[model samples]
Target: MMMPAAPETDAVRLREAMTESLKTSGALDDPAWRAAVAAVPRHRFVPGFYLPAQEPDEHGLTVWEPVTADADYGRWLAAAYSDRTLITQFDEQEPDWAAPRVRHGGTPTSSATLPSLVLRMWADAGIAEGHAVLEIGTGSGYSTALACERLGSAGITSLDADPKRLETAATALHSCGYTPTLAVADGWYGYWPEAHFDRVVAVCSFRAVPPALIAQTRPGGKILLTLSGWMYGYARVLLTVSGDGTAEGTLLPGTVSFMSARSHAAPAFGNPAHWVAGLPEKARPVRHGPERITAATAEAFHLRYLAQCAVPDAQLTTFEDTVVLVDVVSGSAASLTPRGPGWDVREAGPVRLWERIEGVLDAFDASGRPGPGRFRLCVRGDEQFLSHPRLPSLPLPSVGYGRASTTGPSASRRMPGSGR
Candidate 1:
C-alpha cells in the first residue's frame, strides 16, 4: 500500500485541539500520556477523506469518510484526533483494505473509540512506570500507541482478531516509532507469551470475565475491562487479579460501548419455543418508549451490569416503526409499542421487568434523583451489587438485562439480536 500524502496543517490543528481537550479533561496531567497524545498525529493512522455539509444552525457531523480521497482528507484526519469515534470497519468495508467499499450503518467491528473514554480506561488500568500491559483489540493502534507512550514498547503487547487490522496497526505503530508486540489472534484467548503483567486492558466487551484473562495476570495485577452486568448500565470495571487468577472490581463512573470480542459474538435471535421457555417471571405487560430508554441508557457500564443480571442474553434491535429489546435468557421482551397518544411499553416474561425497573426508579423517586455522585458499587465474585440515592433500588437477584417479550404471531419485521 502506498503512503498517503501528509496533511501537516490538519495534524497541527488536531494536536492543538487534542492537547487543549486533554488538558481540560486532566488527561494532560500525566507527563507520559500527555507526551504520547501530543506526539502522535491522529491523521497519520486514518487515511480517509470525509465529506462535509452545513445545516441551518449547526454543522453536519462528518458521518463517514471516503478512504481514498486526497483533497478532502483533512476532515478525516481532524476527526481522527477529535473526541469523536472514527468507524474503522462496517460490514465488509475494512478501512485497512482498498477503498470504495460500500458502507452500512449497522455494526462497527473496530473504531478508535472516543478520547475521553480512552483516557478513563487508561487511568482505570492504573499503570505505573515499566508496568507490563496486555491490550485486547488493537484498532488502528491508537490506544496501543498511547500504551507504548506510557509503558514503553517493551512492556506492551496488543492483539486483535483480524490479521488485516493487525497489519494496519503494525504499520501505523512502526511509522509512529513504537514497536509493541502485535498479534493476530482472538483477544478472548489473550496473549500467552507473557504469563503475568501489571495491567490488562480490554477495549472490547465480554459476556463474562474470561478465565484466560484471569489466568494471564499475576497476583495484585489490575485488570481493566468493560464488563456487562445488571446495574444501571454497562460499567468500566477495575479488577485486581487474585493469586488464583480470579479477580473482581467495583464499577467506575462513565460508560462505553464496544464490539464484543469475536470469540464471544452474540447469539442468534430467538424462536417462539425458546422465548416461551425463557420467560422472566413477575414481568408486567405495558407500553413504553423503547428508544427513550435505549438512548438515555446507552451507558455501556450499566448495560454490562444488566447483562450480568436479569437478561444475560439481552440484545437491542431497532426497526423502522418499533424499538425492541429482548432478554432471551428470561424469555422477556420490551417493545416501545406505539399507541394513539404516544409510545407505551409492552413487556412480557417471567419477571415483571418493568415493575422491577420501576422498583429501581421508585427508589430513585423516593430519594429524589440520585446522580452519579450518590451512586456506590460493590462487587464480590459473581455477586455484583449497586446502590444509589433514589427510588426502588432493588438488590438485583440475577445478572442480566430485561428481555423484550413478543408472543403475537402477526409480527412482521425483525432482525438479529444485539447482545448488550
Candidate 2:
C-alpha cells in the first residue's frame, strides 16, 4: 500500500494563500520578497488584535473588542491571514490579550500595516542583499521579521518610541527565531548609534522628513516614508540623501497613510464641541467662482496636499456641501459653501483663510493640474521646500517662508499658523 499523504498545516496553508494573493494582486513582484513573506509567521507576531464590535452594548456605543488566537483559534487565524491591517493597540495602550472583553471608543494608535502595503514599500526601497536597513516604528515586529528574513538579523535595526511596544516586539521577534537590534527611542531622532545605514524605512508618517534621518543615512541611500499632516492627507515619498546632507525626491503615485510619528503627532483637539463652540468672531461674505479644486475628485489628492503644504496646522472637514477649514493655532477659520454659480466665503481671525485657499486652488489649477508625482521635495538643513516644474517653488510652513507671500487679498501679511 502507498503511504498516506501528510496533512497540511494551517499556518503553512495560510501563508501560501497570502503569498499567492499578493502575487496575483501585483503587490509581491520579487520571488525573494515572496519567500520572505511566506517564511515569516505573521500570526506569531499578532497574538491578539482589536476588531470593531459587531453590535453596540446596552449603552449604545460602538467599541473595539480584543480577539486572541488562544480564545478562538480558527477565527483569529483567519483574520491573521487576511490581507488587511490589524489594530494591535488603542490610544497607545496595549490590549489585555488574555481577557475576552471589549474596550470602548479609542483611536487606533498602532497596527500591523496591511501586508501588501508593507511589501510594496519594501519593493520601493529596493533593498539589496547585505544592505544595512534601519526600520522606524517596529510595531508588532511583522515588518521587522520580513526585513530580517531578507537582509539577515545582523543587517537590520528596528526602533520605536514606545518602550512597552518595543518590549512586546522583542518577545514576538525572538519567538520567530530572529533577534535584530531593537531600540526604544523616538524615530524622529533616527537611532544615531546605527548611523550611515544603507536604507531607512519609516513605517510611521510625519509632517516633514526628520533631519536626523538624512544625517544617519549614507549618501545615495534612500529613505521611504509617508508624509502626513493635520489635514489627514498623506503621500508616500522615496527620497535619496545627497552628499551635502540634503535629500530630494518626488512623491510616489499611490496613497499611503500611517500614524504620525509619536514626537510629531499634533496636540489633541479634545471634544468636537470645543472646536466649534463659537461662531466666527467676525464674518464677511466674499464672491468667488465655484471651487475648481475639491477633496472629492481624483485630483483632490494633490489639491489637499497642496492645501496642507500651504496651511500647515489647518484642520479640514467636509459636510454634504460645505468645506470647513480651521487653524487652531492662529484662531483662523473659514467656511466655503456653494452659492449658485459662485461660492460664499466666510472668514474669521487675523488670517485671510478663505482667500489663501482660493489662491492655492487657483495656483494648482493654473499649473496644468499636476498630480502628486509631479511635485518634488528638496530638504536642506532644517528647511524643506516643495517645487513643481510648472509652478513656482513653495516652501513648507515648517521652514520659514522662502518666497514672497502670495496668500490672499492681504498678500503682504504673514500667513498665520506656521508650524507642524
Candidate 3:
C-alpha cells in the first residue's frame, strides 16, 4: 500500500502548524477567531522580505540573511498569520517600499500583532453583532479583516496613517471579497466625523488616551487599547467610557508590543553615545540588590518614576553585562549604565536619574506590602492621576522640562500627566 504523501508545501505545513497552535492554545472553540484566521489569505498581506536568523555574539545578537525560496512565501505567510506578532516596520518605518531589510535588531515600528491577542482584545471590547466599531491603526489590515468579519461591512470603519499600507490592505480585502470603509488619517484623532461608536479599538499603543477618542465614543461604549511606556510590559486596558466622559478599566494580564500612534510617536533620544560618554566620576555601586525580579514589578517601578520624575522621554533596555537607560528631554539624552559592581550616569545635566529610579523601588519596598491590587490609574481629559493602595497622589516635580526625574528629595508627587 502506498504511504500517505508527505506534507507537500509550506502553505500546507503552515495550516497544520496553525491547527496545532489552535489545539494547544485552546482557541479552537473561538468561532469568530477561527473564521477570521481561516478566511484571511495571509500570504497576500506580507511583503517580499524576511528577517535574518539571529546569531548571538559577545557585543549582542547579530542578524544574517534568511534563506529565501519559493516555499518561503508560505513560511512567511504562516509566521505572519500565526498566534504571535510579526514585525513589519523597523527602526522608524518600512525600510523599503516593497521589501524590508533587516539591520541591527532595531526597534519595530509596525507589525501584525498576534492573532490570539487580537482576538482576545476584540472580544474583551465586547463587540456585539451589528455594532459600529472604530478601529484605530490599520497595520496590514489583518485585524481589520477580523473586525469586518465579526461586525459585518456596514458597521465597521478602520483608519491608518500610512496611505500605502491602506492601499495594500484594501487590495488584499477586495481579493478576499470583503470591504470596509478604509480611511487615510491619523488614527489618534479617532475619526471624529464618524462618532458614537459602540466599540473603539486601537491596534496600536499610546502614551495617553486621546481626547478625540473619548469624545467620539458613545457613552457606555467600550474602549480597548494598550497603555504603553511600561518598564516591564505594556498593559492591555479594557475601559468603559462613562457618561461623564471619563473611562476606567482594569489592566488585562497579557502584554504585547505595538506601534505607537503617529501623533504619540516617541521623540528621538539624541546621540546614544553622548550619554555613554558622560559617566559620573564619583558614583558608587550599591550592593545587596537582586538580579532577577518579577519583570512586571521591575517595569512598573520604572514607569512610576517616569511619571513622577516628569521625564519627557526615557528608554530602558537590559543586556547581559548592563542595563542601559537613555533619557532624552529638550533634545538632549543622558545615558546611564549599570554594570557589575558599579553604576555610571552620563549626561550634561542631572546624573542621578538611575539612582532615583532604584530609590523609588526601594521606597515602595519600604511600604511593607504593595502589589497588584495597590496600583491604580485615573485619567480626566489631559490629566492622569496615579496612586497605589498605600501611596497618595502628589504634585509632579519638574526636572528641566522634558526630562526624567533625577532628584531624590521631592515628596511623592505627580509628573506631567498624560493628555487624555
Top-scoring candidate (lDDT)? 2
Model 1's TM-score against the true structure: 0.73
Q: Which residue pairs collide, candidate 3?
A: 231-299, 232-299, 278-346, 311-403, 311-404, 381-420, 394-414, 395-414, 396-414
Model 3 per-residue lDDT tens digits across residues 1-420: 221234234455575577568757876456766766665655556553345565745557556333122435435554654676666566545545333344666666666676776777787788879688988877777787777766676777777777666767777766666677777776656665456788999988776665667777789898888755523235466777888878766555534556767656656555545555555555455521323232356445334433333333556554444455565553333343466565554434553444555555565666764543355555565565445655544222221222212121111111121011
| Cα-based lDDT at residue 209, candidate 3 | 62
Q: Using TM-score, give the best candidate's number.
A: 2
lDDT of 3: 0.58
**2 or 3, which is superior by TM-score?**
2
TM-score per candidate, chains pooled: 0.73, 0.86, 0.76
User: Measured by TM-score, how close is model 2 to the native structure?
Assistant: 0.86
Runs off by more than 4 Å, candidate 2: 1-8, 53-62, 270-297, 318-323, 337-343, 399-420
**Winner of 1 and 2 under lDDT:** 2
Ranking by TM-score: 2, 3, 1
Can you give the lDDT of residue 192 in candidate 2?
64
For each candidate in the order shown, give its overall lDDT on alpha carbons. 0.60, 0.76, 0.58
Each prediction's Cα RMSD?
9.7, 9.1, 9.0
Report the poorest 10 consecutive residues by lDDT, candidate 1.
Answer: 411-420
Segments in model 3 whose C-alpha atoms lie over 4 Å from true places: 1-20, 47-49, 56-71, 91-104, 230-233, 276-280, 284-312, 317-324, 330-352, 367-374, 394-420
